[model samples]
Target: MSCTTAHAHELYQLYASHLIKRDIWDVKRSVMEQRFQFDPFAPQISCAGIHEHHKILDDLGDEMVVINQAYTRLWPAAQRDCTYLTSRRRVDDTDIYAVINYSVNHPDDHIPASFVRASAEVGMVCESVIRPQCTETSLDALTRQDIQTKIYYQAKISPGGWVPAAVVRETSKREYPKFLHQLGKGCTEHFSDRPLDCSTVKKAFESRPPPAE
Candidate 1:
């Protein structure tokens, strides 16, 4: 089969073993096309190492490992911190409720505000899968703004969730790195069959363990 983007093909080759084993190739394929296509000169931005296509694959493998580890599961369950923001989107009540429920059940074991923000964005895109009307393109300017606010708040409220305010502010701006913009596009294209990858790597944002005194 033809590849969606160079990055997607590279990712398939890189993690073909694990992806096929998990039966996650289908989801990864779309993620590749929409989010992983590499761009050398496309603005240099990195959100938990997902700024480029190759890194996205790295994150997926790492995240899967982290998810399976018992130690990693000790983190508290996710919270309803963004309710204030999600409440505004009356049209997206179903998704909002779903997100709230998921957050409560699955606490983020890993603690990197950037990655948390990234995850929230990914969750929103996933929600769009079920609620197509809420796709990024379909959203009006105001609703989109609300989502940004929600993303930032979600990250802010999480334990040890203190990412730079600039990063939060940047989410609302129009001039993001090319890869992010494309990811946003992918989030909206809901039915596109392009090879995509959405799994993220925890090591990318892994805080270093304290050095021996």
Candidate 2:
């Protein structure tokens, strides 16, 4: 997706916000409810050493662990815990932003007997590149309209229970692009006027204690 009125960093922040604020930003159609088993943005650590290696020591970014109750029209409601990593980087004249989420079993997470356990692995990347047509000499003069964003998304999911893996994969192939489109739309609307305030999230990760050895 390309934005005419948002820069790369601005777009990146908005994208990251949707993931970090999952309880607020997740699509209701996909996730019925979400709760953080381990909030990467919380001020206090929930687990002593669970996420020690998931830290953002460089520009790779923050990580999170969450439990979500999700559903689809073809399958019953299912529950899963996932680990997510979100990051941003600059290569040459382009800015690359990415999010990776995969199913993980946490010792602290307990699944209800009524809920089927599901598994998913998803990867999304957005690249914001400066338009070649732009010839602005001053950095301050560069406008948001000068950047174009390209998005790539991939997912593999098994809804568990009676859902076939092939059916799930086929459904994802058809649906994930729509999901990305919605994400881009949300990002554009969210930062229509100003960029997101990411300091709070950044601080939380920065201040977190190292994972236990």
The 0-to-1 C-alpha lDDT of every candidate, in the order given, reads: 0.24, 0.42
- Residue lDDT tens for model 1, 33-109: 33432222221222221111112211222112111111111134222121011111213322321122112213434
Best of the candidates, TM-score:
2
Worst 10 residues of 2 by lDDT: 39-48
Question: Per-residue lDDT of 1-213 in model 2, one digit per residue for the tens?
Answer: 332222334533554443332321121122322321211111110111121111121122233323333322222334333333333333333345566656665554555565565555556676665555655444445466645568776544444444333333344445445546667788777767875333212322334344344
Against the hidden true structure, what lDDT does model 1 obtain?
A: 0.24
Q: Which stretches of model 2 miss by more than 4 angstroms? A: 1-94, 164-176, 195-213
Which pairs in model 2 have colliding backbones? Answer: 49-212, 52-211
